[model samples]
Target: MHLIIMRHGEAGWHTNDQQRELTETGRRDVADVAAHLAESPYRPRAIWCSPLLRAQQTAAIVAEVINCPIEEKSFITPDDDPGLCLDALLEQPPASPLLIVSHMPLVGALATLLVDAHRRGLPFMPGEAVVLDMPVVGPGCADMKTQFLP
Candidate 1:
């Protein structure tokens, strides 16, 4: 299965919680990424996103272009443990092509763990995404075939 992890677009920091909506540049960047993905050879079966405004908006834009369903999962919430979130996602049934829209540390940490089997966290830039091909064995134990960033 392919797991595509995406970081939300740039968000306004005016709000107290950083739940502010995406800025104009954020929208354009997300659109560019989504458009590129839509024209590419890869396509996701489904999209899952955090409920945060930025994440949700980014997911919506991609979903619109990809014509896929978007499911909100609480595990992607900000400040949530990336390991736990990875565990939860791995426990679920595999989707051939899955897209996960989430925040910085979680997405970065999950990618690091999946690639190296170590929990070293890396910071994913805003609107960046990584596509990983994981073995379909048991959950959280898959081998990585390849990874791409955009």
Candidate 2:
């Protein structure tokens, strides 16, 4: 399976974190990234997104370019556990590549855990995506293929 994990585009501050929306720059950046994916082999067949506004918006942009469907997942919230996210992924049927649009700490930590077998995270800029190739889902079972930086 190919797991494309991404951080949501830049968001404006809101009293409720879930209500924060992407700024204009964020939308443009996400569009650029998605456009790039349209021409790349890493284009996702579907999206797994956080329930937060910014993430949903980001997922929408990518889905527009990739022509894929999006599924909102509660376990991928910023503070959600990477191990649980991994478990959820494992439960998914193997078919097409998946793009996960999520928040900072969770995106980084989950990628780190899958690639390095550690919970420590790799840094990701807004709208950045890391592609991983894994035949099996487990700690240290995946290989980091490349990154899409918008």
Candidate 3:
């Protein structure tokens, strides 16, 4: 299966953390990244995004390019555990690409959990996207297929 995990684009500080929206540059950067994904062979079949405003906005952009549906998942919040996320993913059918638009530390954690044999996490910037091919969900059981960073 192809698992694509991404961090939401740059967002400005707002009074409400969950209400924070993406900046202009964030929209553009995510669009560019999504466009590239649309042109590739790895477009996701489904997209799961955090319920936060920033993540939903980012997911919308990606959904447009990938022509896929988006589902808001509250458990994808920044501090959520990578194990739970993986379990959620495991509930899906096999052999389909899934895109998860979430936040930091969670994004990095999930990515590392898939590829890290040493329990060290990978770092990803805002608007960064990593694609992994995992036959199954397990630590160090996948390969990083591609990445887009800004």
Candidate 4:
């Protein structure tokens, strides 16, 4: 299985973080990432996203570019636990290639958990993505294939 963990694009400062929208630069950055993925071998079967406005927007752009379906997943919210997310994902894995659009530490932690469970997770800036090739959906069962940063 292939997993692509993506951080939402840069967003404006808002009193309500969950409602914050992507900035112009954020939109462009995500679009660039989408274009990059479009040319790559990756063809997403499904995209799971945090329900937060920015993440949902980012997932929409990626899904459109990749010609895949996108859905809001509660476990991917910024504050959710990476381990919980991993468990949920494993319970019902998507197709071979699954994309998750979410926030910083979640994306980074999830990536790390998939590839190297005992180590500290890598950091992900806005509009960054990490690709992993997993033999199975379990801890330390995968390898990082690439990291695409906007």
Best by TM-score: 2
List, residue by residue over 62-139, the lDDT tens digit for candidate 3: 998878999888888989888888777777663368889999888888888888744356888889999999987777
Point out where model 1 deviates above 4 Å: 137-150
Q: Model-by-model lDDT, in order?
A: 0.77, 0.91, 0.86, 0.86
- RMSD in order of candidates: 2.4, 1.0, 1.5, 1.2
Task: Between candidates 3 and 4, name the one with more favorable lDDT.
Answer: 3
Q: TM-scores for all candidates? A: 0.87, 0.96, 0.94, 0.95
Clashing pairs in 2: none
Candidate 3: regions farther than 4 A off: 117-119
For candidate 1, write residues 37-140 as lDDT tens digits.
Answer: 77765577899899898999999989998999999988887677777766666588646678889997788777777766766666787888777767652334
Q: Count of backbone clashes for each model?
A: 0, 0, 0, 0
lDDT digits (tens) for residues 1-150 of candidate 2: 888999999999965897999999999999999998888888899899999999999999999988999999899999999998889878866446889999989999999999999999999999999899989999999999989998
| Candidate 1 local lDDT, residue 135 | 66
- List model 4 lDDT by residue over 69-146, tens digit each: 888899888868898888877788777688899997788778888888853768898999878998888888989888
- Least accurate stretch of 10 residues (summed lDDT) in model 1? 137-146
Could you tell me which residue pairs clash in candidate 1? none
Task: Compare candidates 1 and 2 on lDDT and give the better one.
Answer: 2
Over 4 Å off, model 4: none
Q: Could you say which candidate leads in lDDT?
A: 2
Better lDDT candidate (1, 4): 4
Between candidates 1 and 2, the one scoring higher on TM-score is: 2
Ranking of all candidate structures by their TM-score, best first: 2, 4, 3, 1
